[model samples]
Target: MNDVVGALAGAVGMSHVIHDAAAMVPYLTDWRGRYTGRAIAVVKPGNTRETADVVRICASARVPMVPQGGNTGLCGGATPLADGESVVISMARMNRIRAVDGANNALVAEAGCTLAAVQQAAEAASRLFPLSLASEGSCLVGGNISTNAGGVQVLRYGNMRELVLGVEVVLPDGRIWDGLRALRKDNTGYDLKQLFIGAEGTLGIVTAAALKLFPRPRSSATAWVAVPDPQAAVALLALLRDRCGERVNAFELVGRPALELVLRHIPAMRAPLAGAHDWHVLVEVADALDGAALDDMLERAIAGAIETGLAVDGAVASSLGQARALWSLRENISEAQKIEGVSIKHDISVPVSRIPEFLQRARAALTAMWPDVRIVAFGHIGDGNLHYNLSMPGAFDNAGFVARTGEVNRIVHDLVAALNGSISAEHGIGQLKRDENARYKSDVELDLMWTVKRALDPHGLMNPGKVV
Candidate 1:
């Protein structure tokens, strides 16, 4: 192992190879602190060539490799297992924007580039990269692609899979496959880029990507609407889309508990509406043209909602500060929950229309079993993804509640499966949910996933103990 580390150090310089236990601690643990892994050495590679060399070395030694980006993942996808033998190939130093073609509405960025950096580059070229997440400031673009992240704007733009035009991946065998083509109409053979987009770094290491960009929105409107219930919020969403069409870029559903959590933990974050509401929807609309009167359209649509009893009350943002304030209420839920206590978080997604059913059924089933369970349900309702988290009971410790994770997951995931929903949504099935995910997937689907892993990785060296 020392010889192996020595060779890696020689390849990418000793300064970048971290073998010190204290220095490597940060890379070994996950962002959520749920997964703590062990690694022989954490190698920082500067470019694609260096990454390939590190892969080649690890492959020749038959050692497992865990390709990590910014390591901002909720799941333990970037964390290695407790084996203490795998080498972590950190791509932090490869941050670079290779190219930006404004006319083509595409830009090529290195895997190590932060999502915020990519968005800034798009803005510089008068385009929009609409993948906006709370961790965008720290999460790398490669990790986003690997997980196929779906964010707040997924209602209008789509997931990371749809936003990406092409990828440059270094295969498990240390071979580079540069599939970075920025073509909108490429009906070529296999669509190889799609394979690695959401593979969770199991097949290969993505070093760069060609991402799709949209025209920048010049006018925007944001509103905080109080709905009677989840079903009513769904109706309100439909009304907004009917009146405003595709301009409705974001539609988030915040439950009372979710909002209360934010208000309790987050400082100076007041509810936009006066009285308490069981459910709220944060709707945002935008247009590419300036002075498009989006707020008026939103106001009129919200008026129709109020008339139909879909929404009981509402508040529209009159300025950018107010818009951000409204958005902060929705965005601060996770942080507020963290500050409160440990919880079992689920990133599940069902059909857009079936969201109400999922929520109703899930809450009834959970509370029926654990009547004291604190449910913090909220998320991107437009795309059918909800971050349904359950906090520890008032009398119980976090460990006690977390000890029943298997039992809790069974209840939640079984309902999700019944609703034709995904057990792992946005956050990939890293080690945290790897075995739990197998419980819901069909035998045929699991076999097919394994087949793809074997077909690409062959030796199961890339990100072992992750996904399939």
Candidate 2:
């Protein structure tokens, strides 16, 4: 171990090779604080070459390697195992914007660049990188690609899988496969870069990427709409899409309990409507045309929905400040929930048309088992992903409820399976859901995944005990 650490220090500076136990705490834990791990060292490589060198050193020593970026993963995917037999490769020092090609509608960014930085780079070029998330300020590009992250803007722009054009990865054998092609069309061979994206570092370490960009929207409209139930919210989404076409940028669902938590724990958050509603949606529509009548169009469509009973009440943003205020209410739910207390959280997804059924049946099943369970549900209803969480009003009761997470998961996941939904929507199958994923995936599917895993990581060293 000492010899391997010395080799790692030689590859990158001694200062970058963090072997001290106390100094390695942050790299060893996950974002949620639900998982803590141990490592031989946390190595911060400055560039692709340095990252490859570090991987070679670890591979030569036959030590396991854990590739981590931003460490903002909720599923413990970035956290190392407790065995202290691995080297954690942190991508923080590799932050750089390689290029911005306005004509090509693409940008090349190093893996360590924050999601916000990527968005800003595109904005500077008068283009848009539309993946918007609550953790955009802190989460890194590599982590997003690894998880195939989906955000609110997915309704218009799609997720990381669609946004990423190509990737540069350091394979398990310490070989760099540069598949950073920026072409929009390629059909000569298998789409290789996709194998690494959403693989959770089990195949290799993503060093950088060529990402797609879009024309920036000049005219926009934002609204907070009230609905009587999930079914009405789903119907409202369909109506808006039909009326607005592809101009709908985001359609987020916020349940009553989700809003209450934000209002109670997040300071200065107020309800958008006058009366308490069981459900609400944050809708945004935008267009690149400068003089587009997006505001009036949304207003008219929303008015029509109200008359048809799709929406009960609504508040449309009149100014940029109002739009931001409306967005803040939806974005702060996770933070407020954290402050409120621990809860069993699930990032599940069904078809957009089946979202109403999922929400209704999931709540019914959960509430029946734990009569007092507080179900806080909200997410990208446009994309059919929901951050459904279960908790209790008091900490005392919540503790007992949390202990039954496995039981709760069985019921929720079973329903998701019945509805042909995924157990994990954006969050990767880290240690948190490894078993659950295996339980849900078909035998043939698992077999194919293992085949790919063994082909790339024959020694089972790259991010061991994760994904497949």
Candidate 3:
């Protein structure tokens, strides 16, 4: 392939090596334009020693290597397979931000920065980088630590593998592994940055990170409730964490066909509450103490969850533009279910008391096998995670509801593995759940994930096929 695109355009230079198939068409598709492939080039590399010299010339031309970022992956794991051999490595030009420290709250960055520029460099150092997302302005903190990303403050700061701490990676023999270490206590031996944070890059190339930072809440509260299902939104998220204790930062559930597809395609989305019920949660409460009585602790916890019935109506955001218009009806239900079409997304995760018995057995086994299917449930029910999508009813035809997405992902990943959940909770099985994660993982968890992908990609050549 032109000597591996002339050694990745002589190691990151022919203007960041794109090899025109129309400038490698947006790093050859993903971000749910599902997958697309073919790549004899796409390189970009502007740091970590030119991404370890383009992974040592594609590990000496054995070729394969995918590691993309900000391709906003929803499981094509930054696409690239249909056997175009491989070579994507586009960490959005290693967009730097290299250090923030603010008395060791920690920051470092660069694995192409934007998780909203590391939450605006942890709010310009007054700190707080609680990985909030809905693609925090185009995902990338190395694809949110290569998909350890679970957002909506993972119910207050946790995941991006616990707000990372270190990782530099490069490995598939091009050896770099700096293990960044912005130390928040380390016991050393084999922490190995939790095997390249979420190993979606098969086991290498994360190029930068140190992460972790917090303390910027300074009082907040936002509500939206109206429940009566999903077990009264998990009993009003355990009665707002027992009357707002750890300051419940985000609970989020939103159903009623994901708020009627964000009030029919989100332009001035309304309905905070006036009728439709069937479930909705969207809670929030933060602190760090400036003006501390957070709106009288969100009006005495929504008047004691509507006098103990666990909320059957609520509203609370008297401004921050009505708490961003009640978080734009739960962040515009995945852009109005991508303009009302092609849906069959799963992103599961159970056991927060099995999320109302996994939404009543995945909506009674997907409406008893597609009986005019159209679930469109919602997510982060305070972290039992669900985006359990489907969409097709209104008299179907979005290519027959995306041709029944493999029978609606085998009845929603076989009832999310019978409630042991997670066919992929924070979207990272790429190649759309790699053969359904090899039939729901476990040949001893896919042989200890192929023994850590043959101990750091022993020639599987980085992101080959993907995730293991």
Best by lDDT: 2
Q: What lDDT tens digits, residue by residue, belong to model 1 across residues 1-468?
A: 998999999889999999999999999999878899999999999999999999999999989999898998988999999999899999999999999999999999999999999999999999999999988899999999999999999999999999999999999998999999999878969999999987889999999999999999998999999999999988888888999899999999999999998999999998898988889999999996454478888988998889988999998999899999999999889899888878999999999999999989888988898787888889999999999999765636667887898899999999889889998889998888989878888899899998989898888899999998
Ranking by lDDT: 2, 1, 3
Q: Estimate each model's TM-score.
A: 0.98, 0.99, 0.38
Q: Least accurate stretch of 10 residues (summed lDDT) in model 2? A: 288-297
Q: Total clashes, candidate 3?
A: 1
Candidate 2's displacement at residue 147, Å, is: 0.6
Candidate 1 accuracy as lDDT:
0.91
Q: Write the per-residue lDDT of candidate 3 for residues 290-383, one digit (tens) a residue.
A: 4437877777878887887878788888778898899878887898888776777888888777888877876787778756777878888787
Model 2 pairs in collision: none
Which should have the higher lDDT, number 1 or number 3? 1
Residue 148 CA displacement from its true place in model 1, Å:
0.3
TM-score top scorer: 2
lDDT of 3 at 73: 80
TM-score of 2: 0.99
Off by over 4 Å in 2: 290-292
